[model samples]
Structure formats: C-alpha cells, structure tokens
Target: MADPRSQVEHEEEDGASAGELLIEACRRNNTDLLADVISSCGGEEKAAEVLNNTKTVLGNYIYHEAALRGNYEVIDMLLDQEGFECDPINTREGDTPLHSAIRFINSLPPTPPSPDNEPSAAYNLISMMLEAGSDASIRNKANLTAVQLLDPRNVELKRLFQEAAEEAEREREIAGLEAEEHEEEALEDDYAGSGSDSDFDPEEFKRQQEEKKKELAELKAAKAEA
Candidate 1:
C-alpha cells in the first residue's frame, strides 16, 4: 500500500500545481484551462478558496489580472465562482478589478466603430463586471473611481459607466425606502402590541384637558386681580 504521508505530499503538490495553472489560465483568458483547474481543486469550496485567496507577487488577484488584460471569458467564469469576491483590493494600488479593467480600456488605442453596432468586447467585459456587483464608485489608492478613470474621449464607455452608476444609486434609494417602510411597519406593530393604548380612556383624557384649562384660567384671573 502507498504510504499515507507520501499520498498527502502528492496531493499538496497537485494543489500547488493547480493554483499556478489557475493564474496562467486567468492571465491568458483560458476558460478551458480554468475550468479544468477548478475541477482539480477537488470541490466547489476548495475552488472558491483558491480563487479568492490567490494573489500575485504584485498583490493582484486573479480577477485583477484577468481584468487588466480584458479577459472576458476568464472574468465571467471567475464571477460565477460561488464565493469569489467581485471587488477585492490589490495591495499595490489598492485598486479593485473594476479599476484595473478601466485602466486597461484606457490604455487601448482608438478603434473604428463596429459595422454591426454591437458593443465592443471591452464594453461587454465591464458591463459584466458591473452586473456582477463590482462597485463603480469604489476609489483606489490614488482616490480615482473606476468611472473617473475612464477615457473621456470614449463617450460610449463613459455613458455605460454613468448609466450603471445611476442605476445603482436608484436601486440603493429604493432599498432605503423599502427598509424605512419595514422599520415604520415594525414600529407600528410594536406600538399596537405594547398595550399602551389598551387601557387608554378618551373620556378621561378630555376631562384631564378641561381640568388643566380651568386651572390655567383661575391662575390668570388671580394674577390679574393682584
């Protein structure tokens, strides 16, 4: 029989190999290789842990590396990972993957419009990241948000990011209103259940008011007489 110690060592080596492959797969936008690496990770939980925790010497996560290269397929797959973080900050520039993506787009030379008028791959990639919950408003160490980092001449991309930010703001407002409504309802329910009104007597309340008014009138008259 194989020794247990040797078996464990082999598994460790396999895991390390798979991790290195994962990074390469992301960098190269190799979805097939990435999928294979995920399978080799032994399970979903392990895959997620590896995907989330893997970082380069420069502190870029796999997601950041993929975004920096405009690797749409790899980014899409990474986003689908059960516990993958959409906005992990890299230590180098404190930039989230979204920021890295914008930087990549900004670096590219201008291209002519597509004949079909379909969005460009960069547009699609950034859109997917936004849809996956990457915050466009998150600022990096230089204090520049992803939207702000966008190339000004790229009006189409600017509009895309602006619309996303607006939509996110609207969603937040709606959520805030919903939370307030729920809070108000809860307070109403608590007030109803508190029994404070159960023993209330309208007649007693009116009588007490009248008594207070009469006392005030008498005091005023005595002061006038004096």
Candidate 2:
C-alpha cells in the first residue's frame, strides 16, 4: 500500500514524469516509489504515453538508469511490467541496459586481490538482464555485443552471460515452433470447413439423386400401364 499523499506530493510539487520518478527511485534504491508510479499506468502504456512509459527524453529506458546504479530491485519491477523491454538501446551509444552496466564496470577502479569476496554489481546486473531475455548477441552502434564489452579478466561474468543468452535463445526457438504448429492447425481446420461446403455439397446432391429415382419409377409405371 503506497501513500497516496506521497504520489500527490510528488506529482504536484515536483511534477515528476513517470520516467523521472522511476529513475529517481532506482537511484535511491526505492522499489516502493517505483511501484507506485508504474501502477498508475493502465498497463497498456506505450511510447506515445511518454509520461508513463518509463523512458527519458533521449529514449533511455528506466532500466538504463537502474543498470548504472546497480538497482536490481527496480530492474526487477520494470521487467515485470506488461510491455517492459529489457534490451532497449539508448541512442547515445546504442547501448542496452547490459551495455550500460558494462560501461559502468569498465569505469570502476581496479579490483583488489580478494575480488571474489566483493562480487561485482555489474556482474549481477548482466546476469539479470540476460535472464530477462536481453539478446546477448545484439551489437551496439559500435558493433559490440554485451559479451564483447566484458572485462576480459571477469571470466565468471562472461560465462554466466553466455549461458543465460543461450538459454533465452532456446526458449525463443521453442516458442516459435509452437506458434507455427498452432497456425498450421488453424489453417487446416479452416480449409476443412471451406472444402466440405464447396467440394461435397452433400444436401443438394442427395436431393438431385432422389428426384432422378422418382422420375425413373414413374416411367416404369407408365410402361406397365400401357
């Protein structure tokens, strides 16, 4: 239960756009505020509904901001929405959320010797994006896939990303095959219905046959009477 007053205050005082509210909430790691704003939308919000689409003026998706700050909770909420796209590319670098996170990681200070103890936020963000079906194979304007942008020394991150990408690809292929099967079945049923009416015309054929039989019997009776 969000405080309606908070929403009112944010809207009236700050005049915050849904995208703004969502991005700010990600920066603050505030999932509640993010949920409140998204819930206000009718769930059919599109790019035309700019205020509620969770995209910035420059076409950066809310996930872009979340990735920069390692806000996984906000990322999770956005991904759960009906029309959420995990791999929306920012025009600046044609970078997806995964790309943004990779950039953030590249800008970080060198990892200490005990890197395992301090797991990278970028690693987690990459994993989440991949799991949510971000195409690992999509190249940015620089023609660099998310895997190509990885820090070479981060073997674990690359492996996890590659594995998730393969899994998503397999799922997509399976879904496509299922949809094709259903479409074929629908076409076969439609053809069967149409062909039965046109090719057979069973009722009309039966009526014509009955009329011919009656005529032949009448002729036989006439001959016998004569």
Candidate 3:
C-alpha cells in the first residue's frame, strides 16, 4: 500500500485547496502541512477564520476531525490559532470537538500499564482539550455531556473529567461573585455621587460637627478656669 504520508506530501505539492489540506493534515496528524495551510491563509488572523470555516461534508470541523483521530499535535496547533474556537459543534449530533475526543477514546482498548507510570496518551489529549476551555457540560444531541460519554470502566479518565468540571464550576462561581461585588460597589458609588443616601442629612451632619466643636470649646474653657 502506498504510504499515506507520501500521499499527503503529494497533495500538498499538487497545490490542494486550503480546506482540503487542512482536513488531510488533521486526519494524518501532519503538523507541518497544517502550518503550511495556516500560512497560506495569509496570517494568524485570517488563519482562524479559515480553520473554523473548514469542515467536512459530514459537518465536522477540522478540530472535530483532529479530535476524532486523536491527532494531539494537530489539535494543539489548531488551538493556538488566533481566535480558534474550542467548542465548535458538529452538525449531526451537536457534538463539540471534546465530544469527538471522548468518542475516539471510547473506541480504544484499555491502555496497558505503562512502565514509567505516565498518563495514557488519551488522557493527556483530553486534558489538553479541557485546559483549552472545552466545556465538559456541553450536551450532544443524545443529551449526553462529554464526561457522560466516557467508558464507565475508565475510572481514571472519569476522575480527570470530574476534577476539571469541578474546577470550571469553581471558576464560574468566583466570576459570579466578583461580578456581584463590582455591581454593589458601583451602586454604592452612584449613591454617593448622587448624594442619595436616605439616612444621611447634610444639616444633621453640620449640627453634629457644631456639637463636637462646642464640647471641645467647653472642655478647654473649664480647663482654663481651673
């Protein structure tokens, strides 16, 4: 059989369209070819537009194709593209690239124990996607989130997804709290600027100040008399 790498090289040399090159690069995990495709788009700004727009007839984006094939390097490169979306949904199942990655992982045989005790390649790839802001809470057309699609026997993978989900929730809560605090501060500032504090009266404040001065003056006069 002809070498797939050689075929991809041939296609590149033959001047395939940017979309075709991108699909091939993602499928083959050909980072060099993918880089060439991005450069062909003129620059990073335009590259993101082209990358996001390139999709298969099946309605899978380049990121989805890369994730489905477990193309780690290609996915990494795609994520770095300026303005590249981490959560583009495929047309068929409303599945994000993260969902596609889980599907690929589910198809694999259980990973053999590694001598070095390192994380499995699948684990690393999913972690990378999560770190890149792929929302695990996103549900596919089947009403299943990415974590829900994970093979139940894969306990370690499940833990990883759970931890990521928890971290995301914490970050969201922190953001919400911060937003509320800012709004409260803004309201207080507006109230102060508008002089609309119902409990505060300028006349009462002046009267209190005069009373303080009178008490001080009286004390000083009594000390002089003594």
Could you say which candidate leads in lDDT? 3
* lDDT at 83, model 3: 85
Model 3 clash pairs are none
Q: Per-candidate TM vs. native? A: 0.77, 0.61, 0.78
lDDT of 3 by residue, 1-226 (tens): 1111111222244667778888999999999999987887777766767777777878888889999999999999988877888888888999999999999999998887688878899889999999988889999999999989989998878989988876766566556655655665576567679979498665665575566556555555544553
Model 3 earns a TM-score of 0.78
lDDT of 2 at 62: 64
Pairs in steric clash, model 2: none
Q: Candidate 2, residues 1-226: lDDT per residue as tens digits?
A: 2111111212432576565776688777798987776667556453213322345556666677777777778777776666566666676779888887777777777665454566566666776677676777889999998779888887768778766765565556556655655665575567667775456555665575566556545555544553
Taking the tens digit of each residue's C-alpha lDDT, what string does model 1 give over 1-226?
Answer: 1111111111444456655777789899999999987888788877777787777767787888999999988998998988777888888888999999999999999988899998988889888999999988889999999988888888888989878876766566556655655665575567567756566554665575566556555555544553
The per-candidate count of clashes, in order, stands at 0, 0, 0
Q: Give the Å error, residue 169, model 2.
A: 5.3
Segments in model 2 whose C-alpha atoms lie over 4 Å from true places? 1-14, 42-52, 110-120, 168-226
